[model samples]
Target: MILAEELTKILSSDQVTQNLTILQQHSQDESFHEPHLPDVVVFPKSSNDVSRILSFANEHRIPVVPFGAGSGLEGHAIPVQGGITLDFALMNRILEIYPSDFCVKVQPGVTRLQLNKELKKYGLFFSVDPGADATLGGMAATNASGTTAVRYGIMRDQVRDLEVVLADGRTIHTGGQAVKSSSGYHLNGLFTGSEGTLGVFTELTLKVYGIPECVMAARAAFPTVKQALNTATSILTAGIPIAKMELVDSRSILQMNRFQETDYPVMPTLFLEFHGNDNGLEQETAFTRLIAEEQACVDFIYESDSKERKKLWKARHHLSYAFRHGSPGKHIEGTDVCVPLSCLADSIEHARKKMEEADIDGAVIGHIGDGNYHTLLVIDPDDPNDRKKAHEINKAIVEFALQHGGTCTGEHGVGLGKIRYQRTEHGNALDVMMDLKRLLDPNHILNPGKLFPMSSPSTLNIN
Candidate 1:
């Protein structure tokens, strides 16, 4: 009852639960990783509560894992060590909004959709969306990026500062309100994607944007993936300043039709969007249509009405779910590799070819405007061979991407899934990362089995 006694003192009995139901809820994220239930789960209502809990946990050398909405595809939110899972649900609040400064200071549990809904009155919105309605703190933790990343950038770009509760229970603020700063140690960069290993986020000061004056969504179909990827390449080279560009292969298109129950063209397609002032909107649309036609477009469909535009993107956001709906009882292995924009086409082609040769049942969809694509491998999770084949394909895809100056994961942070690739991806630089993790979390009490492997901290090699 020592664990119960301490946590109950910091938070009420209701705030700290040893109930199996709540522990089960915090056991896993939306990943294929093995789940481990924490000994106790604590819901902190404010920064001071979080500070006290972390301080106590640190003193006892107990593992502490911070959990948000549990929407992460990797196992970033899982409490593998099963010590104390700190849930920030009670901290969900939009503390302040500054329209003139174009930013907002918020509690960690605020979500992207919730934030944008409030920002609508002031014509402001948060840009980064990692598909799920993930909490802002979780988004920042993963450096999550989504459809608008090509234009507005990722989670790292959205942050102006963060109120962090370190492993030792000390409170510190990273960065500042300024849009840009050459401050000490670049704590923003250090902790933004640290995945809660260095410190737990208590408050986040994030950048937001004024809503575009006009937005036009279009669906352009091509007879083949090559043609579709080529069109994306041309669009990038053309420098058209479009807002969002996504590529969905025919395989994914078939599933999208099944999932959305819409008979969109059963061909590879690009979901494109353009935003600008009212003056040249039509001209921009016409210009984009012309560019697609030049790249062997089968047909191009446009959505100008705000409601229809939202519907179109909403369907796009649920592509992975669509694929899952079509294939029952199959787990998804996302081959997330991002290369240089110039090499994106090559990278995708390589992935497609590899999947074909392996006869893996999968579909391809991507935020291609920024050179990141995921080959969704939906397979029977119970089959060892299927799992092995999927990993082989993913490893090959990551190797190809790394060779082409790409990363193993673009938007999804490296949790337990991609931990093996760190040595290969970061080279000797990973050593410094391990050193930093050890330095900040001397007891290794923070999210223990993520980012870097704990099996051999000194030896980078892993079997």
Candidate 2:
């Protein structure tokens, strides 16, 4: 057990919360998993403080779970082993804005929406947007990507640099302000999605993009998911540079309509966004319509007005909540899978059939342009049978994706949910990962019991 005197010496009594209720709140994230409360919750206000706390924890061989806002779908921020919960909420601040370089430096606790709001003053915005108002640090740690990832790319792509605190109180800058680099080791890439198992990120320097001159958003409907997916593929094959293309099935549409109090056709639909000047937008829309027609699309409607487009996308953004709203008292379990573009349609169809065979009710949604999709499974948390069926469905979906040359997860990093498939998916690569984990975190004090299963007692030699 960690000594209270040592902790108090590191951080103020006010900064360290010993309350069981507060610790419980910090234990679990938005995942459906049971909570494991940390022994103590430490709110560090600076990089040095974080480093010192980690140094002490490393010396004591105590698990240190770096936490952001705890909005992750996966159990990324949960303190599974129940040690110290390092909350970055107090460190929230925008450190700097390099408008000319198109990058911003910020603390880990700053949310994406908060960063974007500040960036709007300079006509710049960070593009990697997961649906939830997730912290930028949490987003980077998870390597999160959402609808815009089809065009702008993931959090790893947007990150320019990271100020990471290693296990032994060492601070290192992984990347830099330069737009491109052929530097040594590519440590930035290694830590971006490390999910706090490697180190705690104190500050992040992220790449930002200039706001588009003109934007056009559209919704295209089809009688079936096959047609909607096919339309998306056709549009991509036709060389339309769509900024964002998302697939929403009929079930999800009904949920959206009920939750948002707005009516959309209860059919498989594709939400699209085009970013360019007026003429380019017009051409893209025309080309999109032409390609979608080949896939038997029922209708293709475009919204050019900014207000109306925001309203439309807002509804799309609330899809997960809509699923939860539609099924009261049920928890939402979303499966994220990415298949090769050639096999995306088949994969979706296979998953849909499996859900039907199991008599499970869920909705299929996708960042179709990238061949990545999610099936939101709403299940009664109180029912063990329901939970078992959801797991089976998840397993089937993951297996289907792997069979199709796809990853177990698209954007949501391998937290507790996908750990079982690491060996199956990566094969020999898993051995290399184990080596890497040992080399960096020999003590295994950082977010223990996550990302990888516990190593055999004989294999661990922490000294």
Candidate 3:
């Protein structure tokens, strides 16, 4: 147990909240999971403070869970074992910007919107947008990717370097500012998607892109998801370099129309964005139109004005909110699966049929250019049967993805929710992961019982 006097001497009493209510509030994330409050919540102001806190926690064998914006869907920030919740809200700062180099240094707490607002002055932007205005640290932790990821790539691709404080109070820098390197093992890759298990990310250097010379947003309505997915696959195979391609099923279209007070046809829709010079954009648009016609698309509408394009994406971005609007007082549970381009159509159809048979209420949306899709299930926690049915549907979807050549999660890291499927997905590689976990965190103090389940110390030994 951590002594009060020791903690108070390290941080101001006010900086460390011992109040149960406050601790409980910081425990869970934005999901339906029951709150498991930390024993104490500490707001650290700097990397040194984080290092000191970790040192104390390591010595005492107290679990430490790093807390970002708490906007995560999988309870990644939750302190399930009840020790210390290191909230980095105070560390929120944009450290530096190098416009010429097309990179920026930011504290973990700075959000995507905050960075973009600052970067707008340079006519540059960070592209790994995960819909929610999540913190850069949290985004890096989960390796989050969204619509733009089809072209700009995920958080891992954006992150050039990270200053991470490990379990035993050692702070290390992973990677450098260079565009590419084969210098050593990829520590950046190891820590980026570790979900705060291996270390606490204090600072990050990330890649940024200049605003496109020309941008266009378009929507294609298909008679069926098969047609929509086919159009996406066709666009990819033809090497269109589409900036973004998103699929929204008819069920979600209705929910969006109701929520946004706009009347878009309730059909499986494909939302696409193309970024390039004016001529390139025109060529891509013409190519997409031809392919859409080949796929028997019902309609293809284009929005060229930036404001109008933003409005179109705004509606699509608020899809989770739309589902919540239809099912009042219900929480949204989203599960993602990515399969090979050849298998995406069949896998999605299989998932759709399963949802219909199980009588689940949800919508399918995805970055289909990457063969990644999510089925959003709205469930009322008050109804146990509804929750169970949603879980069953999610499990089946994961199984289908795995049986085919796909991952259980495309971008969302394996926090508590997907930990059970880690072994099933990775097999013996799961043992290697356990070994890495034990090697980095011998005390098991960092985000205990997450990413992977707690295994006996002997089971984790690599040699």
Candidate 4:
């Protein structure tokens, strides 16, 4: 019997499906990368099932791609080589929640939104919101961070421990429930953004936070991108406790206005939020307004209304989708580059120039507080020139960021999209990563065509 047939023995008939529709859904992410359906999709209900599946794949050298929400933009979940795709949806569950310790242990398939809804009952929440209701395991796989990362930190920071199933079917928990540790290896950090090249996540122990006593949201409009960056940098420099600082360029604002039906000003804008004690939040908002105005803010508006606050963030989170909807059949490819705070303006300026020169049509949205931004590139699949231009613009952006002591990807992990830039970004460290990959997964049964440049195919199978 083949691997899929063997999987049926481990899981129930309903759990192991060779259905083409399911395979196709698990094949790709929300990226422009070409999709390839897996030979079969298996839904594992628990960690032992995951271990059994991995052991079988390791023995047969069949590529095992872990499928989460399929919301990733870097094509991290794509089953490049035909094999079994492991869908963790059935495993979605909150195993435990310790409000006093401010931590939660959850299964791999639980999503950020779902967990947050559960956390809300206890006045707690998982702060990393990547816009998508992405699975916590998938978020950890990418080390995802978003607007609130400015305060609560990235997925890597929130992760306290992980239960991972290895290629040979051995299961290991990386960290403990303790607030901090000086353990043997910081394995949690290693696997948080390893993109599943190392192993599959079965369970995750993550940190959570109580909802702030006071919360306020604002929108600061600027005449230019430089002005907006200056205000954002000034806010960071002054050490204001801004929970979220998102930079939305004029083009993106227009896209949002069109798609979201909101009459936001067509200018470079910062969507900011402050979290603290009631009086302290008021003071911080006043200080932030002063800095924004001093830095050429056209207008600054603040609101404590929860519904209005949600509306503002809703528009910010839906930016990529707005751009995609704006460009009907065109494929959307984005560039994720993060740099030092001091070099952010220069990098954004360089990106603006490149986009204008290449005539690549895309919208700009970023988390300015953390120096990570993305130029959501819209590419025409049929037009070779359009694809070339988009790719060239992406390369230029990556090269500039690397030269400026920045990374090729900020929040998005190195998957099929940014694999080529890994060697250039990490240099000699790339070799070490490859060695680790070999040590952990000798047969390369996990995410075989991702992360490492050598593993990814060069030709574009853009269909």
TM-score for each model: 0.95, 0.96, 0.96, 0.96
Candidate achieving higher TM-score, 1 or 2: 2
Q: Any idea what lDDT model 4 has? A: 0.88
lDDT of 3: 0.87
Q: What's the lDDT for residue 286 in model 4?
A: 95
lDDT of 3 by residue, 1-463 (tens): 3454566778878778778687777978886667797777888889999999899888778888998888887888888877788888888899999999999999999999999999999999999888889999999999999899889999999888999999999999999899899999999999999999999999999999999999999999989888888889888889987999998889889988999998888988999999989988888898899999998888888878999999899888999888887888888888888888788888888888888998888888888888899988878788889889998998999999999979988987778889889988999999999999999999888998888998422111111
Q: Write one digit per residue (lDDT tens) for candidate 1, span 1-463.
A: 3687677887889898888999999999988889899888899999999999888887777888999999988899998877888899999999999999999999999999999999999999999978789999999998999899988998998889999998899999998889887757888988999999999999999999989888889999988777887787777777776889998888777887888888889888899998787657788778888888987897898888999998888777787788788788888777587888878767777888888888887777789988899888978899998888888898899999999888999988898899988999999999999999888888788888999876412211111
Best by lDDT: 4
Better of 1 and 3 by TM-score: 3
What is the Å distance of residue 324 in model 2 from its true position?
A: 2.2
Error of 1 at 279 (Å): 2.9
Model with the higher lDDT, candidate 1 or 4: 4
Write candidate 2's Cα lDDT for 170-241 as tens digits: 999998999999979998899989888889999999999999999999998898887888788777777776
Q: Taking the candidates one at a time, how many backbone clashes does each contain?
A: 0, 0, 0, 0
CA error at residue 293 for candidate 4, angstroms: 1.4
Question: Which residue pairs overlap in candidate 2's backbone?
Answer: none
